[model samples]
Target: MQHLDLDFVRQQFPMFQTELGQKIGFLDNAGGSYVAGAVIDRLTDFYTNYKVQPYGANPISNRAGEAMELGRRTMAELLNVSADLITLGASSTQCFNTLSIACTPLVAKGRSAAAGEVIVSEQDHESNIGGWERLCQQQGATLKIWPVDPESGELALEDLEKLLSNKTAIVAVTHSSNIIGTINPINEIAALVHGVNAKLVVDGVSYAPHAWPNLDVLDADAYVFSTYKTYGTHLGVMVVREDFLQELAPQCHFFNMPYPNKRLDSAGPDHAAIAALAGIGDYFAALHDHHFAGKKGLPLHRKARAVAALMNQHENELCAYLLENLNDLPVRIFGRKTIEQREANIALSSPKISSKALADGLAEYDIAAKNGHFYAYRLLQAMGVADMNDGVLRISLSHYNSLEEVERCVAGLRAMLG
Candidate 1:
């Protein structure tokens, strides 16, 4: 509310001033946030100082190894989960791929023949949905689809309830709609999936940047998100429930001891980026401290709640300005009409201008916007916007964006739309 310490926060990101020769305004934070200074410093430190295989006798290797362990705990704290249950990987796709493979053993040796199916909603990104589809194909398991609402850009839980049966071994869903900006009811979805004795997996790639997740309270068997989207370096983080971790087979070696967290990570990661995620923990904790200065009793949920409240309030104002100005301009909003009803990502199609042409035009004015489906195919198809594969011109906001900038953006768009 106090304008987010503009100089201090902006200083944390050196790229903001230098990118596009200092004139570009970043409106694509939902795609990926600019890395903060703490993350950059941590990444550089990993390369120059602790760049070695961890846990070896060498002093540097031990520190590198320690850095990795510390990073795990930091990630755990960030997600409000146990450190022992966290698995780090290269990307959300890779992590989900490895996870699906690990679940193969369970489906293969199912206690009941019916316990081999996995259910997925059509609106999820290719990252989570594609891997499961391939896994189901190979395992001779049934892949069930849950319908999404076309008009509201929302998932239909009643459809999901009808699809669930004893055969459903796992249920995977996106925590948010990247294309339409709808925040799905993941907690309720998790409850329904788990009630049917199925493991609930969540794709948080779009949700995690704007929300600080509470893994223990969220009730998902496993959660996945990308560090880059969260303003950290590039890496994939998976938080698996301790009990569910036991069901996953090892990915590394046949003789590898069964550890819940280690077994699911299939590939070796870039130590620099994986370690840089530690900075995000530092960033969140610092923000919490700033928001709750002199207050120590607040737990993770409260701190996260405060931060989210500020962000939502800030982002809503931006989206309201954009939507109000864009009204009657021959543009059709891709999601709900107001940001309060959805996240602050405004995706719109223009009858007068090609989406890409408008995106480029905005770029020429030093306004950074994007035009694409954002990989939410089912949302596009349901909304009947699939023909515009480059469906909408997108402007996604974050807490750091200012009210003045929103006005500037609306002014620019009005001129461009004219």
Candidate 2:
């Protein structure tokens, strides 16, 4: 495998050429990533040329409709799912909430004395946990939490098996923790959930930026991620298996129930944003061609996987360096302190200084690190961190980050700790 061409990769993102991007080491990518130039250009083109109501019987309208469909088709191709199965929404939170509402009516039926069970992971963001909890409460279903190991910040599969029973109707979890950064085994979990005839919904917002997961291989009932976090527009992309889509009640109007794409979205689609998301596919194809020359004719998903492999290798190197330095400093690092078990997100609490103080100090060195519970408030509270207000300092990285940037971040942390 060829090593990532950092220069070629950095050129795709216009942010790196900006004065602020040049001066600051952006380690707060988990909050959101800088958009690629392709996405920006596409958004501009849509508004300039095709800003009409799509699917109408006119020239500009037809072009607008084609652009919107192209985005959906490209995203579906990248995820290895059918185009009709994918829905572009406002955000991942909205998507999950809509899904929960649609599922409540269906799953509430045939309940036993124990009530139907929905298993959620404590490590998930509020988007994944809260919606299901609300559904369970409203429908008189039991909500079970799959707890993570307080010391290691790991979710054990054995514990998940214990929670599984015949009453389980749904299991919601994250593909990777936004705080801990540990990559969960979705395929295994999907199989386990399927064995009990329960639906599995995966939150892929954090993981999707690092890797474009093959939904066919994962076989999840539903999967969701944010395009803005993956170098695209500010919209959420969700894929539901056809059978699963049929199982849920329509959240949209009665007339739209026949249309799979419109069944879940309550409002009109973001036409410009949906059209711009095709840029993600454009960026991925560009990266693949640049790294592996003449490897053309491959499917979009295969190209995405190829680009992902290159990104993962580069990111792991950066993660390894940060882990070594933080471990040497003896900071209380959360999650697995190894590259093989986690993504590039690392959260650490300093015994000598408050997390907020450390984050504030790092800013002086032009390192944009963040300190907070990061919406995984329950995870922090469960880990016995007394200062949830201060939380831990999180250093999140993406493929655009370089070794030199990692060294600079480490140097900043070292100086602050010293």
Candidate 3:
């Protein structure tokens, strides 16, 4: 396999050319990534040419509608699902709230002698956990916990299997933990959840940037991720299996129930943001072409997989280097000890200094790092970090980050600690 060209990859993102980018070492990619130039161009083009209401017979309206549809189709192709199965919302938090409400009736239907059960991981962001927990509370259902291992920061499949029961209506988990950065065995979890006749909902927001999830391989009932985190516009893209889509009660108006895709999104769609999401396809295609020149005739999903493979390899290298340096320090690192089982989103705490102080010091070296629970409040509490205000220092990296940057981050930390 060909290695990713760092120079070419950096060129695609206009942020690196900006003054702040030129000075600061941006390691907080897990929070969000720099938007690609292609996405920006698409957004601009939409506003310039098709700034009217979509889906009408009028020329501008038709073009606007077509652009929005193209974005949905391209994103669906990236995830290996049908365009109608994809729903674009304001954000993943909003989408899950809408989804949980829609799925409430389904859970109510499954309720019998025992309260209809909903199992959620302590390892997930609040965006994933809160909505489901609230839904369970509202319907007087039993809410179960699939707890994570506090020490290793990993979730066990055996624990998940024990939680599954015939009354289980939904099992919500993360494709990868944002704080821990360990990639959970989603397919295995999906199988266990499905065997018990429960639908699986996954939060792919953290994992999507590192590697695009193939919903076909995952077999989740529904998967959610934000486009902003995946080098595109600011929108949350959700993929609901057709079977489950029809089962959930519509959150949209009565007229939209006929259209399964529109049923989940209650708010007015952001026409420009939706249209710009198609640029993600363009960005991936460009990456594929740059790395695998003259290799044509590959489908969009295939090309995405090819790009993801290279990106993951490069990210693993950065993760290993960062872990090696941290291992030598007195800091307590979260997640798997090996790079093979984790993404580049690393969280750690130093015994000598507070998380905030360390992060502040790193800033002095022009490194952009963050310190907080990062919305993984429940997980932090479970890990014995009672105080959310003083959370772990996070150094999240992306494929665009170079080995040189990793070395610089390590040096920054060492200087601060010493």
Candidate 4:
């Protein structure tokens, strides 16, 4: 019930100060979020004190290993898992690739016609789909799709059930779509997939920013997200069920390997940035203390709930304002019509309006956003906007964006169309 202290929250992010000389209106949050001060501090501190090899006899190296340990503990708590199950990587895509490799030998050897299958949604970000798709293509495994409904941008459970069978190996989907902004019922999907003896893998890159996931709630086997999207360092974190880790094959150098966690991070690790991810957790703790007002118990969840609530409210208002302004214009707005009814993303299209031209036009008036498929190529194709090679103009928002910024964007859009 507490209101957001926009001023205080904005201060935590240095980029809000117009560091780029001009007022940079960043609506490209779906691509990557701006880093917070606490995250930056951790990155700086790590580079200063422990920029050396880890797990060595030297003091700096020992601290380097310890720093990574802190990150493991911190992210585990944030994602609600044991530290042993947590693995840090360069990006979500890379980690999933490693995961895909680790899961290879487990795929059915085709002794019978009902060979194992991996169920991937057509709506998944390329990172989620490509790794698994390529795995199926090369491994002689079958790949089944939970296709997003072309009109609604949603995948129905019944459709998924029809596609699933005892041959199911894995069911991978996004917690939320980066394009259409629809939140998948991951918990329900997991139940359905698990009934068929398959594991669930969730891509939380978009959801992590707006909600706190209780890994237990979904009963998923593997989950992944990019820390950069969570107000933290530029890193990706993956949590695999301990059972899954043990069953999977090694993915990295054998002599240098420690555990399944190590085998999964092919790039070794970015100790400094990983430590910075812990700092982001510290920042969240501070925010919880400051924003919870009178709440008690489960501080992390309280903070997560408060932040997500505020963001949802603010983003809805912004989307409403933007949609209202564009209503009479030639633009064909995509996704849900009601702002509060949708996730914090808005896409506008026109019969012949070039998304690039609209984006470039907005840039001239001091607005920033993206034009094109945005790696949500399949979603665009489903929405029938794929032909707009430039795609629809996208305005993605986070909690930090303001009502004033919304007005500025509206004005810019109006001017461009005029």
> Which has the higher TM-score value, candidate number 3 or candidate number 4?
3
Model 3 per-residue lDDT at 337: 64
Off by over 4 Å in 3: 109-114
lDDT of 4 by residue, 284-334 (tens): 776666777566366454466556676666667677777788786877776
lDDT of 2 by residue, 1-418 (tens): 5899999999999999999988888999888998988888999999999898999889999999999988888888888777888877898888998899888755574346646789999889889999888898788788999998988877889999999998898999999988889999998998899999899999999998887787778878999999888988888888888999998888888998889988887665689999888898899999998887789788888999999999988998999999988888858999877887789998999888999998998898888999999889888888878988899999999999988888988998888786
Model 2 Cα shift for residue 183 (angstroms)? 1.0
Candidate 3 local accuracy as lDDT? 0.89
TM-score of each: 0.92, 0.97, 0.97, 0.92
TM-score of 1: 0.92
lDDT at residue 262 of model 4 (Cα atoms): 73
Worst 10-residue lDDT window, candidate 3? 106-115
Question: Which residue window of length 10 is worst by lDDT in model 4?
Answer: 296-305
Q: What is the C-alpha lDDT of each candidate?
A: 0.77, 0.88, 0.89, 0.78
Per-residue error for 62 in candidate 4, Å, reads 2.6
Write candidate 1's Cα lDDT for 75-128 as tens digits.
Answer: 876666777787888888899999998888656543347548888887788788
Q: How does candidate 1 score on lDDT?
A: 0.77
